[model samples]
Target: MTDKQSKAREYVLADLVDATNEVDDAMNLLTEARYPVPAALTAHLQAAREQLAAALTIAKQGDAYRPRCAHQCPNHAHTCDRTPTHLSDHRDQQQKGTHTCSWPNEPDHITIRISGGSDDLVEVEGCEGADEFNCWGIGLTGWRGDLIGGTDTETLRIYAIYNGIWTFAATASDESLPMPDWPIRITDHPDVGHSALVEIDAPAGTRLTNVTALGGDR
Candidate 1:
């Protein structure tokens, strides 16, 4: 880890310790001060504290605890940086293409295009002011990226034109479009001023073409 990352992890560990302490204090008062706390509630607090401790243990390991690539990859738990060689035992099991991290270590903004395609996957090409699709999260964009209809972030919407009709495919953080075989069209809120088109099945000679974004503030 870099000096900055180590420092950040330390800060996170400290915050977790503080939170654990707070929970312990609450449990103590309920059990020792003769307060008539419900038995079930105290049990819940104990469980919460245990969960926090488990999280703290994992946090202490820093990136060592993070998955290296796709979850199904055999070396998923191996602590390789951006360019670590694949462990020999798992050579045949490695992911195709160059090794890529399963996650973006930083925030991922949702201003991108669909730059590539595969049998079952479409590459989300992050553009200026955005980060590449890190292999984990809701759909294409990971947890940090703003989904077209993600409720937690600035709300915009993504629509799909299929069989001569436009249909809603996303509406909140937990909702997003499935990998599409047909051409995809997105019309952003007029105030947002962004429009996009994605073709998952382009002509044979061309790559899955364009997630071209028209003029916008993104």
Candidate 2:
């Protein structure tokens, strides 16, 4: 995430915390009020609080979820540490050109692989009930494709390269709507070639679902 995006997320989290606190205060006041508070109003306020709390929890959990290191450090004899704090310090050292062997370099090849099917399509596990997903690839000859949702049957055409990485990402406001059917097609792009391999990324705790897609169909 860019610095701007990080700041935006922080702002949103702050807002959610404030909203939750306000709701708590209202509920407390109602409990202490001399007059009886309407039961319907109290229930509505409680529901809103629950939703905000759930959203806050989810926001805090993701944005850092990823597979464990694929390579081990020669010096430390352990996999690279990708914790937020360690990664931040490691990045700073790299920029300063004083990096050491704290973290091992990422493998040139993809650590997690999506088994490809006919027509260059692949099934990305852990996508059922996901509100958003990010697809990235290394050694990709083609950079454009479409993502078809399994349950909702929605198709998202994507083409982009972020920070020099071939990437395509999407989000849905309706969290209830599950996106991406099990096997999503990677349309052939003769202009560039085709996808060699891909890594599918969904938010942490996303449920896994399997489905079949032939030539980008159900």
Candidate 3:
């Protein structure tokens, strides 16, 4: 994720914390207030607090939800002493110039895991193998995972690079797809020339849990 994206996430996470703290502080102030406070105004405060509580519950669902590590340290001989959050995406290690969790070097045949997070409209694109934009000679190239009930809908899409054209491969939304869709294969499709790109569009209310996406068969 970019620094801007990370900062946006930080603010998102801070919402619940800030809301709860505000309520607590308000209650404390109310208790210490020497002057008479109107019951009507207090009722409004109580209502606002209730709304914040509800919002927090909804936010917490996405807050606890996040995309897990896309890849782990392929170098088992060398432990990835870095934190889990750092290894969640290969790009992070790549930018840091660390090999602790070098997953980007080998993005093909990789599996994706969806754990928890908001349906914050996330989009990512990547190519597999030596060729820059083709799925040829590559195994499966998609993500397969389950969802936690947080929104009305969620969708996963795939596009194949056939003759330099991004063509639609397949799509699944909510429970439309079953468990273990092993690989998003393009080997059968003759048009798949060089590489394939998988894109996921998650809205604000989405919560995917217990997810896994592998480029090759498990």
Cα lDDT of all candidates, in order? Answer: 0.34, 0.38, 0.35
Local accuracy of candidate 1 as per-residue lDDT tens digits, 1-218: 44644554565566557767877887878878655778876875675575455545655644221222333322122223333354432212244455444433333322334421212222344332233222221111111122332223233222221111111232222235442222222322232222122212111222212121111111
**Candidate 1 off by > 4 Å:** 64-218
Number of clashes found in candidate 1: 0
Residue runs of model 3 more than 4 Å from their true location after superposition = 1-7, 63-218
Q: What is the C-alpha RMSD of each candidate to the true structure, in Å?
A: 17.9, 15.7, 18.0
Give the per-residue lDDT digits (tens) of candidate 2, residues 1-218: 55644554465556557766877888899889999789987885675565455545644643322222334223222324355655642311222222244434443211222323323334343343322223232212112234434333444333222222122222232455554322222222233332223344322233333222111232
Give the range where candidate 1 is weakest over 10 consecutive residues by summed lDDT.
136-145
Clashes of each: 0, 4, 16
What lDDT is reached at residue 133 by model 1? 28
lDDT of 2: 0.38
My TM-score estimates for the predictions, one after another, are 0.33, 0.34, 0.27
Show the colliding residue pairs in model 1. Answer: none
Per-residue CA lDDT of model 3 for 77-174, tens digit only, reads 12234565565532222233344522234423333322111111112222111112211212112222333223334344332211122222333433
